[model samples]
Target: MNELIPKETPSLPSLPETVLPALDRLVSALGIPRTVLASSEEIEYAWRDLPRELREIPAELRGELIARMCVAVSTGLFDGAMNYIWNAAVLHLRNKIRTFGLPVVAQIRQSDFEEKHLLELQDSKLLELCLKLNIVDEDGFFFLDQCRDVRNNFSAAHPTLGKVNDREFTTFLNRCVRYALADSSSPRGVDISSFISAVKGPRFNHNQSGIWVQRLNETHDAQRQMLITMAHGIYCDPNTPEQARLNSIDICNGLTNSFTASIRSELINNHTELVAKGHQDKHAASLQFFERLGLLGLLNESEQHHIFSRAVERLWTVHNGMNNFYNEPAFAERLLEVSLQGAIPETVHEEYVQTVACCRVGNGYGISNAAVKYYDQMIQNFSPREIATLIRSATNNNNPLGRRVLSGGSYRFHFRQVLNLIDPASVPNAVNGSYIQLMR
Candidate 1:
């Protein structure tokens, strides 16, 4: 019978001798039940796992609340320990936001943000603000939010929704420490208000602009994407001041090398939204935004056509002006560059093909030699639709570019070269007859 008796459950580890006794004396003197706190056995279980979390945090973060948490854990008051952890975490996040700057938060949130508001933010709102500021990343937000819920429900901050076991409390501690406490040092937020002022002010020269670009590089990826899109929106706003528009695009151009697919998708969505709402001025501005950023490939075919057609019209008008050769290359080259960004939209295939041929073939006098390569490169990539447009245009002798092809000499000779540049495979069966006529 004695041999069949159960053995005792071994103790894990212990805290200071006086820690739980002092708490017991205080609670007993206050006539409180000892059972209100967890058992020493439970405390031992929870405390064994605590050191790993405590060790991972820096010495500087082990402040008053952290010390209080240690005492709370030693006294078997897991609720109080978590409450202390949560308080410490909240203060750390607020300090981070303060260091990031209130004005910048005001700018991003589009509301009056001050120290008073920061102090007054409720816990849930505080978490959301941290998420928005990029002070807390997405995964951190998830875990921290769970911690906050646990702190409210199971910790001593409020009446218990349900009791948390030693294991549950330690798990909460790990999450709070790892996600919020341990990860606090990285991902500094940008002061977007001052940043916006700098961008909208006079202008940023290369050195001046490079400084802002460097500041962006120092921040988190999400915030960097946010600022990039913000710059795009400012550039696309119809009422934005001219210098500001120039400054906005200039800043974006610097960050162009680092653009991700996410950033491209965001810009495209904004452009598409404006177009859908028939916000013509902003929509047109957005197309120019993508064009200037060399991101036309992100735009849909319709938007690209809109961009190309406008570009072609502007250049064609310039090409027909006085000193056409000297005055035309810059605008003509811009048009050619825009076409190269993506496939020429079929909607403007006729005008697009004719404009390039006209610029390449020149008028009665001479061509802009600076623009010849741009025109030639654009001609060489003509799709079957575009090749057909160029050929079909030649059949209409009364049209401006068609008239140039029929006038013979260098004009007709240049047209023949343009036809030679087109891939015969690209010529559709429908336009093969016209293609043969032009080639001959």
Candidate 2:
């Protein structure tokens, strides 16, 4: 248990020394026995004994609940203490449900229960629903229900047909503090931005990283998802430092399977949205994510193939008819990266070759620098037939536009590199000798 009480008590205005005297007068006026009044020392002890987790409760409730518990214990008003315990439990449960979001809360409502009817739930039913949602475990639910029974039987809110002893009341109060106030449904101390910063920072050593991974494992699903989503953003940002990106990837790989699944879904969704919006620069992030997935060996063969194929198709869509391929360099580089990672399937090799071969130069200045980088990768991966098809497509007479784009100016360097890869005899007769000489 965390320390709820400070080691030393300062003079508190809410718990004044005069409070007992006023209570004594009230008890006297009611003709109650004076034996019920307890000493100041006992009140202080009760306050000191409160659990640390309870200190994190909302300030309004924490102050009232602590004061009331202290007064009840000091005055031997066990029945009243039980009532306070019940109130604290109810407040914590309600707050937890609200934090869970309305979608989950709606699942708890009765079919006919309207939004205004939220507060109509009885305490017992609320505990039951929380238990159903796994918000509270079975033992917690049982213990809270038992506390409710005690409150109903002896607390001041009821007729007090029975009485509870100080020991029983204290036990109930401690249980409420543990099960309700300390529930995991509450927001964790760590937030998404801070989590991202920590992961991307170089300060966290191996032991610290292990500790964070354990925390992620224990974190609630909603909060874990938020952390992953933020981490993905950092990982995808092109401006993110290289070391930070690598660190982020390491952290993400350490996440639980559930977290990984959420990341996968989020990436797919982002890709779909970017495609729909026709945002070219944003698509680079998705391609980067795919390359990372390949490099990390996180993706299975089928998933890798699917992602690569979709990426190629998207590239095809973007560059299909446009003369200037704004993303051609990035597209070609990502293809080579993915291919080098061994993620691209042999089945897609033909399509991959054709896509690069058919891609048009945006302008004289916008040569396919990525395609130049991709030359060695293509040589290593492409079959002879595929290589021949690529050369023919770039140099064939029927496709004068393709021939002009490949054989002209700076593009000749890439064309010569391609020629060097295949049999010299396989080269088309129409190839310019000047460009071929430049290859030497």
Q: Which candidate achieves the best lDDT against the true structure?
A: 1
**Candidate 2 lowest-lDDT run of ten:** 6-15
**Model 1 compared with the native: what TM-score?**
0.71
Candidates in order: C-alpha RMSD to true structure: 9.1, 14.8
| lDDT score for residue 49 of model 1 | 78
Error of 1 at 74 (Å): 7.0
lDDT for residue 152 in candidate 1, whole number 0-100: 82
Tens digit per residue, CA lDDT, model 2, 1-440: 87776433333334566777877788789999866654445555555554443454445456587678655766667677777767877877876666654443453342443335447778898898677555677899988888888788878888977665545666778778677865435532243445666867775567777777666665565456666666666766677776776666666667734555656666667666766787665556655665665542454465567657866776666565464345566666666666666634666665676665545332345555555455456554655556555655565546633555456774555455555666655444545353255346
Worst 10 residues of 1 by lDDT: 4-13
Give the per-residue lDDT of model 1 (tens digit) for 1-440: 45753323334356888876877898799999877778777887888877777865666787899889887888788888989999998998898888777787787788999999999999889999888877887888998998988888888999988777789888888887776777547555678777888988987788988888888887767789998888988888888999999988888888888988888888888878897899999987888888988888888777777788889998889888888778887887798778767777778888888888998888878778888888888888888777777877888887889888888899988888778787888889998987887777
- Which regions of candidate 2 are displaced past 4 Å? 1-48, 51-56, 63-66, 95-116, 130-168, 182-300, 309-367, 370-440
TM-score of 2: 0.42
Each prediction's Cα lDDT score? 0.82, 0.61
